[model samples]
Target: MKLAIIGAGMIVKDYLTMVSDIPEIKLNAIVGVEQDVPTMQELSEKYGIKKVFTNYEECLKQADIDTVYVALPNFLHYAYAKKALESGKNVICEKPFTLKLSEMRELKKLALDKNLILVEAITNQYLTNYKELKESLKKIGDIKLIECNYSQYSHRYDAFKEGKILPVFDPKKGGGALMDINIYNIHFIVGILGKPKSVKYMANIERGIDTSGMLILDYGNTKVVCIGSKDTSAKIQTTIQGNAGSVIVNGPTNVLSDFDINLNNGFSKHVDDKINDHRMYEEFKKFNELVADHDMDFVKKELDHSESVMEIVDMALRDADIQLG
Candidate 1:
């Protein structure tokens, strides 16, 4: 994949760290703000990328680039990704997909129409442990309750407290517990439970944004409780309880390190077989193959899953009486 990355943020830095492990992903170009040019140059020298453009349009015109990675702030995802797809470049958009289901629908339609691969860069769905967890669900028999907690008191919250608003706390930028950290929980649950029959969100609102929240997903057959908070700290855990057994997952859903399966009959097992140390590796590995094969069928299948998650997000936002500006 001849890639053009459009952000010089922390995520991009992390990608560069393990990018060499995925040799097929060629770092063709990087585009960012002029203010970040120095950092961009630093990255270019380190990654051996030849093209660096402060102007995204110029980078988008690079004939050698095959895919665009939209790693920008939440608000820019829609516009940047749409431009990439319109330019006939496949896109791997960082998660939260979009702020609205309408935006997601339009982007999916555009990608399909253009015969381009558009994928949400959600980590949990692509983790080998996550895949294993899915298969392990059967051993647990009938699932009755699900609970997920992904919370870390953000360093950015201190800036917000001092009246210095950063993107993570900015309502208009689509930052909140739900979009920023909670969506991973959403993906982890929705990916397994499918779309809940109904959803409700009750959040701790501050500055017109949800700093922390509990999302209740009513699946007629089972109930799921998803908790994501940026204003508090806790040991993160995801538990799936079934009549016969239970599955326990520790750590962030994004990088599912390992899981334990405990059955009612005293069958206990630990699973740690993983593809790579970096969380993004598995996703990009699968993404590269999907892109290489031009697998529209598989792409659309994942797109549909992303769409369902977005729909629940939209519903949660509405029911919470919160709107992204």
Candidate 2:
């Protein structure tokens, strides 16, 4: 697939580090706002990209491009993905597909009506290790409790404290602990367990944004707690407790690195499936398959799952009394 990148942010560097090794995909161009032309051109040159443009319309007019990777800020995802789909290009949008469920629903309908592929670029759901974790769930028997925590202080927090509200901390830009960091924990849980019967959130608010929050998901028989924080740090781990045994996943929820299984009366097993590459690797591989096979079914399923995630997030925000601009 010939891919045009819509943003040149910190994550784009990680994507470039891996895309160079994949033979099936090509970096066709990098596009950004007019003020970011110099940076985009530099990235294009460094990554051997063929073209660079400051206008979205000009970039979308490139007929050779088969897909567009919308890596812009959270708030821009819906608009950019909609335009890309309208332009007949498959879109691989970044996480928290949109701030609201209505926006995601609209994008999903547009992609389907256009017969195009649209996927949320969430790493955990695409990783092989996560699939294995799902397979091991049955071994643990009836699940009763789940605890997931993904917390790391954001680099932009300092600037936020200084009254410079960056995207990571700005409500107007879909910024908050829930949308930025907590979403990973939600994906790891929801992808495996499906949607819960009820959802609620308790968040620490600062300037109308959630800096840290605890999400409680009730599945009737099972209870799950997801902890996400950008104002503090924690030993990131995911634990699935069941009647017969339990499973423990180490490393961040976004990066499924290592895991362990302990049975009630048997020896425990340690699993180490650490991949050195950045989290973007698995997502790109999945996108390639969706584009090559022209699989609308797979695309729709992913979109539906993303929509559910956003629905839960929206409800959680309401429960916590947080409002985004």
For this target, which candidate reaches the highest lDDT against the unseen true structure?
1
lDDT of 1 at 250: 84
**Residue 34 C-alpha lDDT in model 1:** 82
lDDT of 1 by residue, 1-325 (tens): 9899989999999999988998999899999998999999999999898788988887888548989999999999999999999888999999988899999999999999999999999999998899999999999999999989998999999889899889998999999999999899999988888999999999999888999999999999899999999999999999999999999998988889999999999999999879899999989998889878999999999999999999999999998888796
> Candidate 2 vs. truth: CA RMSD?
1.3
lDDT of 2 by residue, 1-325 (tens): 8899999887787788889767789888888888887888888888888898888988899646989999999999989999999999999999989988888999999989989998999999988788888888888889999999998988788888889999999999999999999999998888987899999998999999999999999999999999999999988898999999999999788988879999998959887654546677877887898899998888888887898898899899889888775
Off by over 4 Å in 2: 274-276
TM-score of 1: 0.99
Model 1 Cα displacement at 178 (Å)?
A: 0.4
Worst 10 residues of 1 by lDDT: 55-64
Clash-forming residue pairs, model 2:
none
lDDT of each: 0.92, 0.88
Which candidate leads the pack in TM-score? 1
